[model samples]
Target: MLLLINVLLASWFYTAHGQGKPCDYPVIKHGWLYYSYRGYFPAHVNQQFVYSCDRYFVPPSQRSWDHLTCTAQGWSPEEPCLRQCIFNYLENGHNPHREEKYLQGETVRVRCYEGYSLQNDQNTMTCTESGWSPPPRCTLVKTCSKSEIRIENGFLSESAFTYPLNKQTEYKCKPGYVTADGKTSGLITCLQDGWSAQPVCIKSCDRPVFEKARVKSDDTWFRLNDRLDYECLDGYETREGRTTDSIVCGQDGWSNKAACYERECSIPQMDTYLNAYPRKDTFKVGDVLKFSCSQGRIMVGADSVQCYHFGWSPKLPTCKVGKVKACAPPPQLLNGKGKEIHKEEYAHNEVVEYVCNPRFLMKGSHKIQCVDGRWTALPVCIEEERTCGNIPDLDHGDIKPSVPPYHHGDSVEFSCREAFTMIGPRFITCISGEWTQPPQCIATDELKKCKGSTLFPPVGKPAHMIEYDHNTNKSYRCRGKSEHKHSICINGEWDPKVDCKEEAQIQTCPPPPQIPNAQDMTTTVKYQDGGKNINSM
Candidate 1:
């Protein structure tokens, strides 16, 4: 009974002094306690002690020893000591941070030794709680070193020293050389081992040497299959009866000879009643022939005609027997006014011009002339209306549903079909009653597909493993509810999300009954607590 009373007294003393129960002795790895409690099995509450690390080791705080206190949950800092890391013996690299050992939270710098380099070109490392951050590793250099590249008859398009893997550069040839692909310039790529191809310029066709001709292109060199267009000089024409001709560069030399012969006009045909001076079988360009009426006839039109590259100019005169008369007046035109107003009479071969009013477009010739005392046909003016009628169809694309008479400032969106990729703007706008440049849909192997989210189920099927092609649409409903939604796959991305959500329960009722044989019926309803209540019908 006395021993029981003593235990009860000890519990009461602990509660009164705000002291917690004693804790079991801790066993630390690679460390020991600084103060030895004389033959004590357990530590008392609120007892303080200092712990220390062993050789080549340190506490988590990087100190030789750390303080700990007993608490209700046990000793503070359950694990206090950690092993120290040593920096040495790095292959193909040298450790710049000279230290015997390192504790947690310590950092250092390392560099590659001569004839070696870092794997990613990084040089810094840190000593984390576990070990070195980004463990030090050095490897042999396999990168392509920068150097001056020289081409015999070509030059680099851009000036740069560094060339990463798979990078490309262009080189253009000088005047008399061409690339292997029959082009003036060529591209080369930096491969994993070395450059993909060397820059080279090969001999091509020599400079053009021809008389009575001027080449269209200014390039002095021409590659195989290259065409050169040339035009004949004055008084010269190609053998094909044309003023211009083209020659292709073949493997041996130019395919055709660049030769042009002197031009000659055919003999002129004369009228039976007219006499022409300087009669000849053939005439040269720029030659002129004079005409005179025969006997008592009069001459109309020009008296002489000159030979030009495009046949005769003006026209040969004609012999007539009657006198030229004056015209009464020019006929009026619709939606247009003539420059010659209040003119009662017009002479033969006289001309008058007409112009349409605002918002009108003139059709046919805008001038009228009196020929042989008769006016030519008059031009017509049509109204100018600016408005788009119908949306043009796309080659491999489709547009969102839209209605037209599309006016200014309206826009429409487009999407490519399956297995096709859009190349330009997705949305086109109407400006000044005309649609902007529409995008092109080019066929491609990399077609975009969209996977439906679990929150939305495609119509008539589960969403799992369901893939939608570009520009396609699908409908869904909120789990078990009546509300429906839709989504479209545009450019591999889904837009205007249709998500399923938990719906709040709502109460409703049928329509109120009507009185039999009633003359007039009126219905009144009120809502309370999310339910409809009918008062009268």
Candidate 2:
């Protein structure tokens, strides 16, 4: 009964002095005890720690003091109060294997799961007097390399070199191309290594090919409406021309009808205004085809083609739009504009009128037209009025159909004296009011010094053309003449002298001369009208 009273009194004493902190329960903070204890303030001693060498720690080799005793001290040697941490609680995403326990000075290695790592990343948990050191958390710092990201037929939206975990981007096809299924592929997701899947685009059709034909495009792949231009192989030809040799691509693959044939020319299917006259279905060797354009169009290629053994001499002709006015795009005069102001087009034989700006004068032809698919007399707007200079005289000659007061581009023909040869151009043209080099009446070479001769043709004879050179001699044969005719060249002139008689007829004189003759009578020389003969009979 006295012991119970004493126990109650002691409890009251400890509560009053310790502020409710039980001595046996030593205020362990962020720490665990190494052993069990006993205490009641002013009575029994308290074990400050819980310690066991079983699976967590190795016991000390020697001890100098006993434990669990109280003598003017709080507890007995809580020193040597080593804690055990054989196994640890999981912190999630970290790996801890092999080691079942940890002792003082021993390390506890741990690793985070793939794609995850600890904040400190020291990868170790250590046991100490205080207990296992504060553990690290498993965090994410994922990164992906740009080189690892490969997308086919498409590109990534982000051009960055690296991406964090969960980063996303898009892929798109190039121009004039599309993806299969006619829908955009799902967005790309960054995985542990790289992007999820590569993308590809497929077109409706591929480029077309022919047996003996070729396309001029640099690429071999094509899509809808992509024209596949081609030409026939050498020694071969299509039914018509180059235009007809092409096929188009569609949803139904290639729409080509170009076929190569041997040695034949057919009329091509041409646009409106283009004509190849009398075009039969086909033309054989030696047949000719004439190509022309309508009133408002012009020929863009050969005027005609002939069918040879190797097909058409030329591929074929094309008639293009010929809105050719004096100037299709009227000249930009400094201060003038056309009455009918169309920027680029004009029809054949179309006329254009122009008015000069105020204070400016008009030069050249006022009215211009599209003549035969070409411009004629394009006028201009000038700031000043213009005139031409004087006409220079021609040496030893007079102008024929002379144009006095010669203006720009005015011209005149030149005539030489009776026996004179013309030198230089026969016509003198004026340019910018100045005449071109005037022609001269060149003096003739005097044949009087060289002398001359005449070859007399005999009756029933023919003359043969002969060639002559200066100071040279040549001979000719006449049909009825008994002898060859000889000629000499002097001063760029040829003189021939020959006397012939029929070999079958006698040469005897019967009052030799202009006698009564048969139908084939002939004479070597004749006197001028009303002129007496040098010698009379």
Model 2, 1-537: lDDT tens digits are 765676678768666776442344443322334443333334443423343333333444222222343333554444433455655355566434544756566676676665555554456777785566645456666767668756555666667876656767666765445565554444666776566656665443444446666556776566667676677765466766442366776656667564665556566566577787775998865566776788766654345566654445444545666343333655555577778776586665456666666445555434455544555444455553333466567677776765456654456788887777665678876554456888666666642223223353333433343333345676656666555777666455455443344446432211112212212211212223342211111
The TM-score, computed over Cα atoms with residue i paired to residue i, of candidate 2 is 0.24
lDDT of 1 by residue, 252-371 (tens): 678888878777777666678899878887778767666789888766555566676666644565777787666777877788888866688887657777777655656544655565
lDDT of each: 0.69, 0.54
Steric clash count of candidate 2: 9
Per-residue lDDT of 58 in model 2: 40
Q: Which candidate is the best by lDDT?
A: 1
lDDT of 1 at 60: 74
